[model samples]
Target: MIGIATFLYIYGYKYICKAILTAKVMFMNNLNAPFPLLQSNKVKFISSFSFGFFVFVFLYIFQPFGINEVQFYKPLFIGGYALITFSCVAFSFFGLPLLFKNTFNPDKWTVKKAALYTSFIILIISVGNWYYTATIGQEVISLKHSFLKFIGITFSVGIFPTVIFLIFTEKTLRKVNESKAGNITKQIHTDLEIEEEKQENDIIPQIDFLADNNSIPLNQLNFLCIKSEGNYLEVFFFIDGKLNKSVIRYPLKKAFEQVNELNNIHHCHRSFIANFDQIEKVSGNARNYELHLRNLTFTIPVSRGFSKDLIAIYK
Candidate 1:
């Protein structure tokens, strides 16, 4: 019986430890997920104001914390709490972003950082709420005690609904985008088959290629591809059957504008203009499309916005 009890106790302890670890990991993951960036100060202010308004309305309706017991000046009392919430939200959304730029960045954002930063905001808000009520409202409560209470209030009212909405909206948007991309991908592939037979490059006349205001006779060289590197453009072409690369001090748009009027020369991506005749292959999933030009090792991307135009070029 003693041995059995010991084993049971050990088993229970291990299970609890494992459960705790799993919860911790899940919490971390939730913190790091991608979240939408609050783009402008105007948006931040509006969001804060909206949240404060919500809290005020909810408090007035629900009358929690015995606000109903107060006969006169009840709205005034609740309004003060609303102002606290607004102030806290404003401080968090406006001020914290500048401090946690990378964490709140749309591209690099993760659930983990958002959660941590949100908790930080909640902490500040909880403190503010507690301090306000204790000092002004004259509620006698410890900061530590008020913190948890305020956090619970904020979470129940704001965070929970926002989280649910974000999750549902994100899933729906992803599904729709993926489906749309898939259709576009299929259509692009069909177009690619027809495009294979088109010989649009034949009519292209040799034009001088510009590099730092210096022009090289493009007719002398077999053009392959042109891609952008920030302020400069990299020109890929063949000279005497040997592949050569030249750096031109020009943006992709400017460089391509000069060449796009020519047959088969097209802007495929934000950073790339490709010669269709030189394209060896095109392949990618719905999210992205890549063009493989002849005599080139790397692939060039095709933007979704330009996908229809690219397909139209073949027709």
Candidate 2:
């Protein structure tokens, strides 16, 4: 009786650990952002049973002690083991969706509610285990002690793996937030350079408004920066800064050449060109800068290579 009880306890404990470690590896493989874990209920169930069976057979074959008791009806023992393993695996696999649903929509389960749910799940598993043993007519080696041992095995195998998964998910979220912050800083820097260029242009003396035979003033044209749908650039101009702008489609380099003639054009970033006269202030540290304009704010970043030029403009 003592040997049988010890065997069952050891077998159950090791099987539980194997199942949990397998689940953890599966969770890690499926960590593909926004979908942290896979939704394959069938795979999870199969994996659990396979892990349990593998661990059980490995332990039985490599019996550390000399307590090998040959029993008749060996097939019955194997079948019973398979049935128990499948039941445990299926229960865990089906329950996983509930965990994910709670994680994705936190509003569904408050801390208190989660605690209550977890307790209910544990209770169900414990009662189910007892009922299963009773129906099979298997007497526990030491009922009082084995019950506590079973609880320990279940927690170590199941709950510990879930906790580890939660930790990994939190780390992923932090990385995402850091990436967004970097993009925001870059945008702010671009807007600042545009404002600064506009201000510089305002200080320049107004040139004579030369009118062609059509009475269109060439010197009074307004400047605009237009981003193309893809790799094109278009510069728009409005005469007297009040008329509707006229667009000239050209490569960005060519547009830069035309703007250079006016003495106020600057490349804010690879993606933006700015008129410096509109710059209000350069805020934040040297690594990042904010450009404030009339009712708009943009970011301009000063790389180590461009820092000198940025400072020269401000000075």
Candidate 3:
């Protein structure tokens, strides 16, 4: 009986550990997944200030907190909501990311992340509102009794618009990029073909690509772009019409130095040096731009500093 019980306990413990490991993996996968978000500090600043104004306008118009019953100056009283909102938003979107750099990377941003972040901000807003209600309101109100009420009101008023607007905006931007990227990419392919024909006899320049204890030549490889990834550059190129990539131990800044003579190749992003000949189209407006490369799954982001340079080359 004792042997049978021991066997069952060990098996149960092993399965429980396995299940916990699986759950942990799933949770980490959601958090660490590389989700594309084109947001920057500029975007966050705009959103934070805009949300504060929205709160001001919302309170002024709605008067939801029985503010009509209060005898104090209404605009001055309601304006506090705006300040509270602005502070909370500025902290959540701007300050939190700065403090928690490892957790809030834009490259790995996810919808779940946005939703959770929005919810967290809203909760803080609710707490602020609750404190305001307790300290500033007319009657002697019991704090615990009305705390949940304030939370409910805050979430109802804020969450729907904030979360939905974010999701909608992301979806809309992606659609525009997808629609425009395909057309632009096709045109680029055509342009490359024409340019290839024009430069058929031109001598393709050869440059040395730094590698692990050696150098690699460029002319033989036909590399389309190079991406710097932690002491290695991921080099993309074509071989007999098939796309391929080669990883080399090199720095992107050095690669740009070597390829300066190549007019078609430009260091378009901090992490990327792109051959404009292989770029399908430049996406986004003057404020933000992205490069769609030929036969590549992801679009390369073009930082503001490099946008003018790329636009000049493309034109």
Best by lDDT: 3
Give the whole-model CA lDDT for all candidates, comma-separated. Answer: 0.69, 0.46, 0.71
TM-score: model 3 vs. ground truth: 0.51
Off by over 4 Å in 1: 1-33, 139-145, 164-315
Better of 1 and 2 by TM-score: 1
Give per-residue CA lDDT, model 2, range 1-315, as digits (tens). 999999999999999999999998876554421222323455556555764565356335642221133244434543454455456555655765576665534223233443444455445455554455445524322223255554554444346444543454445544543454455445546755665578665654343222121222223125433333346443333544453433333456655554556545576555555554444444433123434432232344433334345555654
**Residue pairs with backbone atoms closer than 3 Å in model 3 (clashes):** none
- Compared with the true structure, what per-residue lDDT tens digits does model 1 show for residues 15-83? 999999999999877765445444557656876787788879988999776566666667887888789
Regions more than 4 Å wrong, model 3: 1-16, 34-83, 90-120, 139-153, 172-194, 204-315
Residue-pair clashes per candidate, as listed? 8, 25, 0
| Location of the lowest summed lDDT over 10 successive residues in candidate 1 | 138-147
For residues 53-91, could you state the per-residue lDDT of candidate 3 as single tens digits? 877788778766676555557787777777788889889
**Per-residue lDDT value at 146 in model 3:** 78
Best by the TM-score measure: 3
The best-first sequence of candidates by TM-score reads 3, 1, 2
